[model samples]
Target: MIPPAFRDPVHDSQSAFRRLLKALSRPGTPVSLTGPAQPPAPMGGPLAAIALTLADADCPIWLDPALSTEPVRRYLHFHTNAPQIADPKAAAIALIGDAGRLPGLNEFHPGEAAYPDRSTTLILQLPALTGGPSVRLSGPGIETTASLAPRGLPGWFWQAWHENAARYPLGVDIFLTDDRIVIGLPRSTKVEAP
Candidate 1:
């Protein structure tokens, strides 16, 4: 059987949602998730916690092949009851297990002109939050600039991110996570090589 979800679903989900909001408001800053539910393999603490907090019956999810295992699927289904869709464009949130094999940013829905907020949000599982090549972040929420070094991403990630950012309101938001740490990179955040 799948492991139990948040001990206090109401309180835990509220707290987790607040943390995510803070992270997104302060791009590149780390946010720690607090909870007791340990998700199945390939789904780390932060990702699992995020799924529990944000996903629901209305939020359809798309899983990268590596994280599309039965256990992971079952766990999310049991806890969130969110539908898992095959088409990335139809997903409200996309969970990526291997950053190197991640699809292009434009491959997912960027939302339409009338409703840019409908774009998909990406949650990528990374090896670590630091010790890789740093990227300079600018734009909304940042006072001047911020630096981040999310390890395990492909070399072309920043270039792709640059392109994604150029789309202005029509772009996907990203959340990068290690085991327990989560860093947000909203569509408004600009990324550059440092």
Candidate 2:
């Protein structure tokens, strides 16, 4: 059977949305998401919560191969009414399950200078938020610097992220999630690998 989404659609979605915004505003800090029940396999609570909070009929979603299972697709479709697209660049939201084999950040749409908000928002479901080698993060929301140690990211991720951050308003924003927490990495954030 397909697992359920947020138990209380109205309240839960609203609460999740607030936490998502908090994550973004605090960049690199993990925020707790309390709403969603378990989604399908491989789709964790925080990732599912993000989809339920931000996706809608007008949103176009792209799922990486590892997360594009039939059950996951059906669950997202039934709850969000968001259409799934084959092209990552055309997606408003992209859910990535396997960070180790993630696509290059440049492959996704970096919204045009005229409308930066049109860029894709990525949700990466990682194995754990900690226990990996650390990278330094500093930018808008960060007072001085912060550390991120999300496991499973590709070796080239930090280099790619620097290039992404250099684009300013044109790059895609990302949310890193484990099972129950999410950390936002807006394009404005700077990531330095150690």
Candidate 3:
């Protein structure tokens, strides 16, 4: 169902991008990513915001086996010319589903020692995210400190992140979106168990 808000003529795409940028620059800091009243079918405004901020012709995105078909594929193609690659190995951006289906950190491209920044970014749309185990993080862009309520992501996710962070600049960045909200976790942010 389309929300009433999208009808406004002033629905600005720039705002959505700015929010995403702040979050990317400051990992672990939750930012509210708003978008045009309605996004393409299936994917919500938040996910749409992510696509708008990140995807482009230069970026090769991998649509999950689930979303590789029509409308979603066409919508992304029309909106952002990001080519959809068949293999995750060659993809710069991976739009995935079912966090459980994601491969271990060692599996995806973690970039190389010379150009760790070459690693692919995985934009995984998950089932849901809520008060996760309380964990505090403090880093470059963070002020004194910050904490998340506690997410239900499985232990495997954390394990992978730990290993990924170990790779330093080589690790892939993750942008997680539920429906209306999107959260970013750059490689630099340290996640701890409370």
Writing each residue's lDDT as its tens digit, candidate 1 over 54-156 gives: 8999999999998999999999998889999999999999999998899888779999999999999999999999988999999999999999998999888
Give each model's whole-structure lDDT: 0.91, 0.92, 0.69
Residue 33 lDDT, candidate 3, scale 0-100? 70
Question: How well is each residue in 1-194 modelled by candidate 3, as lDDT tens digits?
Answer: 22332333234556766787787787766677775556555666777667756788998887766666586777777767788888787778887655556666565677888988778887766666565566666566777666754344555887678767777877888877776667777777666665
Which residues of candidate 1, in runs, are more than 4 Å off?
none
Write model 2 residue lDDT over 1-194, tens digit each, in one string: 77889888999998998999999999989898864667898888888989988999999999999999999999999999999999999999999999888999988999999999999999999999999879999999999999999898998998999999999988999999998889999999998865
My TM-score estimates for the predictions, one after another, are 0.97, 0.97, 0.82
Order of models, best lDDT first: 2, 1, 3
For model 3, which pairs clash?
6-37, 131-150, 132-149, 132-150, 132-151, 133-150
List of clashing residue pairs for candidate 2: none
Which sections of candidate 3 miss by over 4 Å?
A: 1-11, 149-152
Residue 154 of candidate 3: its Cα lDDT?
A: 56
Local lDDT at 17 for model 1: 91
Higher-ranked by lDDT: 1 or 2: 2
